[model samples]
Target: MNKQKIAVLGPGSWGTALSQVLNDNGHEVRIWGNVPEQIDEINQFHTNKRYFKDIVLDPAIKAYKELSEALDGVDAVLLVVPTKVMRLVAKQVAETLDHKVVVMHASKGLEPESHKRLSTVLEEEIPAALRSEVVVVSGPSHAEETIIRDLTLISAASKDMETAQYVQTLFSNHYFRLYTNNDVIGVETAGALKNIIAVGAGALHGLGYGDNAKAAIIARGLTEITRLGVEMGANPLTYSGLSGVGDLIVTGTSVHSRNWRAGDQLGRGEKLEDIERNMGMVIEGISTTKVAYELAQELGVYMPITQAIYSVIYQGASIEEAIKHIMSSEFRQENEWS
Candidate 1:
C-alpha cells in the first residue's frame, strides 16, 4: 500500500484512534483539535491523556492546533468529530482546502435541525471542487477497542463504488479491516439510528431488566431502525450488514458506548444535563432519539422504541413508564408487509 498523508479532524477518542491506525499503516497522520493543551500533549508527549489514559501514541503522529496546518497538502481527510459540530468543522476544512481530497466521516448522527445525515451535511458545506464523493466509515468498532489495535471490521460505504474502494484501501490493515459497500444511505442510516437502540438497551439494563428484555430491545429496536431506514430510501438488506445490525449489537450492549451509558444513567434517575456534564463527551443518541422520533412521525413510520427513548429524554417520562408504554402498544403482524 502506498503511504499517504492524511489529516484527521476532532482529535477525540475516535479521531485519535484512527490516527494511530493510519500511523500503523505507515501513513503520515496530522491530527487537528481545538484544545491547545490536548494538541500540546499529543505533540510533546505522544499521548492524549483526556481520551486514552494508558496508551502512548506513535511519535510519528503529529497534532496541530491550527486547522490549516493539519490540512496542508493532505491526500485525504477523516472527520471523526461530534455530529453537532460536523457542519462547522466541514466548513472550516472547506475554506482551508486547496485541492481535491476524499472526505470520510466516522460520526453517527443526523442534524437535529434539518434531520439530514452527516454525509449530506458535508456535501452541502464542502464544495465539490474541494472534495470527492463523501464516504461513511462506520460499524461495530469503538475507539477504545480500536485504539488498542483490536480486531475490528467496518464498512467503507459510498454511492460511488470506486470511491468506497479507494477508502477501503486507505484505512484497511491487518487488525483494522474495511469492507466496501455501495449503500451510502443504508450505511449512514444504520450507523446513526443504532445509537437510539443502544440508549434504550442501556436503559433496560439500568431498569433491572434481564437478558430477555435486552435481547428483545436489540431485536425489536432493529426492526424500528430498519423500518425508518427503508422509509428514508435505504435498501432493506443493508440493515443486515455491518453498518446496521453489527453496529447496533456493539453500541447497544457495550459499556464503552456513550449513548448506552447515558441511557443507563437516565434509567438510574440521573438528569440529562448531569449525564452530559459528567460524560465530558457527546452522547449522540440523546439528540438522535429526538431526530429519529421526528423523522418517524414525518415519514409515518411506526417506531415505539424510539418514541420510548424520546419520551424519557425529552418528555421527562420515567423509565418504567416508557418501557410500559412500549409493551402496552398494540401488536402487529410479525411481517406485516408480507
Candidate 2:
C-alpha cells in the first residue's frame, strides 16, 4: 500500500490506538485533540499518559491542537470523537477541509436528539462535495488491547464498496485486520445498540449474578438489538456478524468496556453523575439507553432488556427492581421471530 497522511480527530484512547496502527502501517499520522496538555504530552514525551498510561507512542505520530493543521494535506480523516460532540467536530472539520477526503468514524452511539447514526450526523454536518462516502469502522476490538499490538479484527463498512475496500487496505496489517462489509446500517446499528446490553451485563455482574445470568443477558440482548436493527432496515443476518454478536460479546464481558464499568458502578449503588465523572470517559450506553428506549417506543419494538436498562439509568429505578421487572415480564419463545 502506498504511504498516506491521515488525520485522526479525537485523541482519546481509540483514536490514539488507531493512530499507532496507521503509523505502524508506514503512514504519516497526525492526531488532533481539544486538550492542549495531552497534545503537548504526545509531541514531547511521545505518550498520552492519561489514556495509555505507560505506552509510548511512535515519535512519528504528530499531535496537533489546531484542527486545520491536522487536516492539512491528509488523504483521509479517522473520527473517533464522542457521539455527543460528533456533529460539532464534523462541522469544524468541514470548515477546515479544503478538498474531498475519505471520512471514516469509529465512534459508536446514536444521536440522542435526532436518533440518527454517527455516519448520518457526519453526512449532514459535512458538505457533500468535500467528503467521500462516509464509512464506519467497528467490531469487537477494544482500545486498551489494540494499543498493545494485540491481534484485533474489525469491519470497515460503507454503502459504497469501493470506499469500504479503500479503508480496509489503508488500515489492514498483521496485527490489525479489516473486513469490508456493505451492511453499514446493520454494522452501525449493532455497534451502537450493543453498548446498552453491555451496561446491563455490568449491572448484573455488580448485582452478584453469575455467568448464567450474563449469558442470558447477552443472548436476549442480541435479540432486542436485532429486533431494533431490523426495524431500522438492517439485515437480520448482520446481527450475527462481527459488529453484531462479535461486538456485543466483547463489550458486554470485558473489563475494558466503559459502558460495562459504568453499569457495574450503577449496580453497586453509585450515582450516574459520579460514575461519569470518575470514569473520565464517555460511557456510550448511558445516553444510548435513552435513545434506544425512545426509538423502540417509536418503532413499536419490544426491547425488554433495553427498556429495563433505560429505567434503571434514566428513571432511577433500582437495579434489583429492574432485574425483577425483566424476569417477571411475559415469557416468549426463545427464537420468536415475530
- For model 2, the superposed segments whose C-alpha errors exceed 4 Å read none
- Judged by lDDT against the true structure, how good is candidate 2? 0.93
The alpha-carbon lDDT assigned to residue 289 of candidate 2 equals: 93
As a whole number from 0 to 100, the lDDT of residue 30 in candidate 1 is: 96
Over 1-338, each residue of candidate 2 has an lDDT whose tens digit, in order, gives 89998999999999999999999999999999999999999999999988888799889999999999999988999999999999999999999999999999999999988999999999999998998999999999999999999999999999999999999999999999999998888999999999999999999998888999999999999999999999999999999988999999999998999999998888788898999999988999989999999999999998999999888887878999988988888888988864
Q: TM-score of every model?
A: 0.98, 0.99
**What lDDT score belongs to each candidate, Candidate 1 first?**
0.91, 0.93
